[model samples]
Target: PGAVLDLSKVIQSFPGVLPKPSFGYAIAMRGGAPNENRYFIDGISIPTVSHFSIQGASGGAVSLVNLDHIQGMDLITGAFPTEVDDALSGVLLLEGRNGRKDRWGLRATQGGTDYGITFEGPIGENTTAVVS
Candidate 1:
């Protein structure tokens, strides 16, 4: 949460990547080029590394996420276990919270230029989705 994850430091430590306009999308995994990596959002393949520019970097444009709605984050590199393939470099997965399966839940947040809301509840009995 404090900093973005990078693969180069996997053996050294997990460090937070500073949020800046010039920062690249992700670190080169095991010294691989940036373009060789791949990322996903809610299981959807992200064609572009970032949404802000054609270069598709993720530093500035992605800072707009409302942390209140985030469920969890997972960044896997080196030895990925089967379920994930492609991207010889690395993988970043951002998981959002879903229905509570009982009552109802709501989350909202506001930043200088960003705003977001999240609602979770049973659709028919056991189906759920977290809308942003």
Candidate 2:
């Protein structure tokens, strides 16, 4: 994290956008502050990033979404719907997959502050249940 990120290199990854150095959150889209964004998981809002990361509280939480079960991500910058309010910047909409049709699987991970697990399998011939 020591090395400074080149603005030119970042811009190359996205078309028609520019990177401004002032917004230094570990994960920010464009030049917007973290507070200017929103995050949703499975149609529900996730309110915090770990217990209390200050910057996130001012903006919005960094999602703890697992890519393994993720089905979709939508980040909107300009002109949003009326259903969303209070955000001066953007919205990050995340959608996750239900689970496999008829198979069982388990995944786990741990850190000093948190630990998590996910289990998924079949409930019936055409039904499935996922626990996380």
Best by lDDT: 1
Tens digit per residue, CA lDDT, model 2, 22-129: 323233455665456566776677653223346544221222444445566666666776767865665656677777785799987553333567898888888887
Off by over 4 Å in 1: 1-26, 56-60, 64-70, 81-85, 111-113
lDDT of 1 by residue, 20-128 (tens): 3255434455555555566666787765433353363433244434455556767776786576777776666666567678867787765543566877677887787
- Which has the greatest TM-score? 1
lDDT of 1: 0.53
Off by over 4 Å in 2: 1-30, 49-52, 55-63, 108-117
Clashes, model 2? 1
| TM-score of every candidate relative to the true structure | 0.61, 0.60
Give the clashing pairs for model 1. Answer: 3-16, 4-17, 50-56
Model 2: lDDT equals 0.52
